[model samples]
Target: MPHTTVLPFKALLLDMDGTLVNSDAVVERCWREWALEHGLDPAEALKVVHGRQGYATMAVLLPERPMELNHADNKVMLAKETADTEGVVPIGGAPAFMAAVADLPHALVTSADEKLAQARMGAAALPMPATRVTAELVGASKPDPEGFLKGAAELGFDPADCIVFEDSGAGIEAGKAAGMRVLGVGPRAAEHAPTAVVADLTQVRVVTDADGSTSLHVTV
Candidate 1:
């Protein structure tokens, strides 16, 4: 058993990739291919792509490129990501944590478009949350707070009442910017200084109350 901590919050906001699902292999593969094709650095490409929308990543990597070019490239990246589910799986304890939160106010907020979100979540055999805020639903991506804010609204909770689970620096920043407490997941995410950090949801359990309030018993 992992060391644990308990946080009482009324709602939950979850990041899909790296946070709930493991799709690093497919993500890195796609980004590397895109970098090679564009003569950019694959290392840097992977660094910025993990928690951002494809178009956002492309915009940073090739700022001088036309919007049409980046949009078109994003479509290609989206299609490839949707079609490639290789290595996609649930992060440790994510499924169980999700199950425990099924009755609580919770939302899945993702950088991936709707199609890719469904594909990857399906690949991981995790049920997609009904209140999902995807790239297609947001005006901006991670590090912008749009997705997490949308999630909080969709779940009918104030951002202050939500505890966000994220596995990337961009995601942690987004959550904080949305005025929520964030629980960082994964080693790569620790440097971002989330409200609290955990290895994965394996140590976290949701407690749903009769009044519909929820709290998290987390193993730190």
Candidate 2:
């Protein structure tokens, strides 16, 4: 077992894809297929797609494409992602972690649109947070602080009072930018300089006090 540290915090803000839901296989497949359709490099496309909104990724990769075309293509990609769920699953320990926080204040913050969020999370059999900041609700995505900020707002907590769990560099950046201490999820997250990093949600546990305060105990 890794060393665990106990940190008290007011609330949690989580990113969906790599943070709460495991949909990498389906995400990759959709993006790879879209890459081939657009004559783009699949490797490069995959590299930039994760932790980003579909339209934003499309905008970055196919800058020359018209906005209208990007919108249409993004819709197509969203449909494809929603319709496919061959390998969607919860990140190891995700279910347990979620159960621990069931009575605490928390929200889902993700770069995915509502439809994609519903599809992926549904496929993973994960419970949805009552408060959510989805792509459709925010003008900007991860690394911009928009979604995380929105999440904190929806949870009725100040950004600084929240702790975030995220698996991507962009998501970590967004959390920090929102003024929340972040627990970087996954090995790759270490490079992003989050407040702390953990192997997965399993490495952390949530506790609720009798006074209704919540804290996270993390195994670093």
Candidate 3:
């Protein structure tokens, strides 16, 4: 076992897509298609799409379009995504890492709705947490902190007492805004403003104490 430094925390908040499941290709493809359909710029669309809910992304990219249209496009994209879920992969060390903390107090906070999150998790064969704050449950998405705050609230832990695992700029922003320490995962995660950035979950270890406090010990 690796030497671990246990920090004091009450709960864990996790980001679903990139942090847990590698759905980058799926997300990029969907956004590109939506952008083409709306005659919008793909590059610009990508900026708004990453780490945001489908409806929210569409709304930003196609602001001139009606909310109904955005919602409809989101439905179509989600349906296609949910059915064609073959490429989804679990992030490195995600399975074992999740297993290590399965019994602890944790909740998922994601820009995806419950249905889409469940679909992706199922495709990736990743375990889902009992408590989750999905897009449908929150008024705003990441970079706004609503989802993470809601997740912390649902987990019954103070924001400062929670640690968040995230893989995107928006998710990291939300975690920090919620007053939680954040661990960044994946390639571009370092630029997301997390307290620490690691290549994958394999580099991270969580230590729990008898008093139900937790600390994340990350290698690298």
Steric overlap count per candidate = 3, 0, 0
RMSD of candidate 3 to true structure, Å: 2.4
Model 3 lDDT tens row, 1-220:
5444445667889998889899888887877887887788888878766677778777777677798887787878888777667688999999998898899899988888788889999988999999998877988767888888888888888999898888888788878888889988898689777888888898888787777667777766
**Model 3 / residue 186 / CA error / Å:** 0.9
TM-score for each of the candidates = 0.94, 0.94, 0.91
Candidate number that wins on lDDT, 2 or 3: 2
Q: Residues 1-220, candidate 2: write the lDDT tens digits.
A: 5687887888888888888877889888889888998899999998778787888788899898787888788788888888998999999899998888877888988887888888888888888988888888988767799888888888888988899888887788788888889998886688999888888887888877788777888886
- Model 1, 1-220: lDDT tens digits are 5666778897788899999999999999988999999998899888888788888888988999887898899999999989999999999998888788787788889999889999999999998988888888888878999888888887787888899999888899999999999999987788999888888887777776688666777776
Give the alpha-carbon lDDT of every model.
0.87, 0.85, 0.83
lDDT for model 1 comes to 0.87
Q: What is the lDDT of candidate 3?
A: 0.83
Top TM-score: which candidate number?
1
Q: Pick the candidate with the highest lDDT.
A: 1
Over 4 Å off, model 1: 1-3, 209-213
Scored against the true structure, residue 149 in model 1 reaches a CA lDDT of 85
Please rank every candidate by lDDT, starting with the best: 1, 2, 3
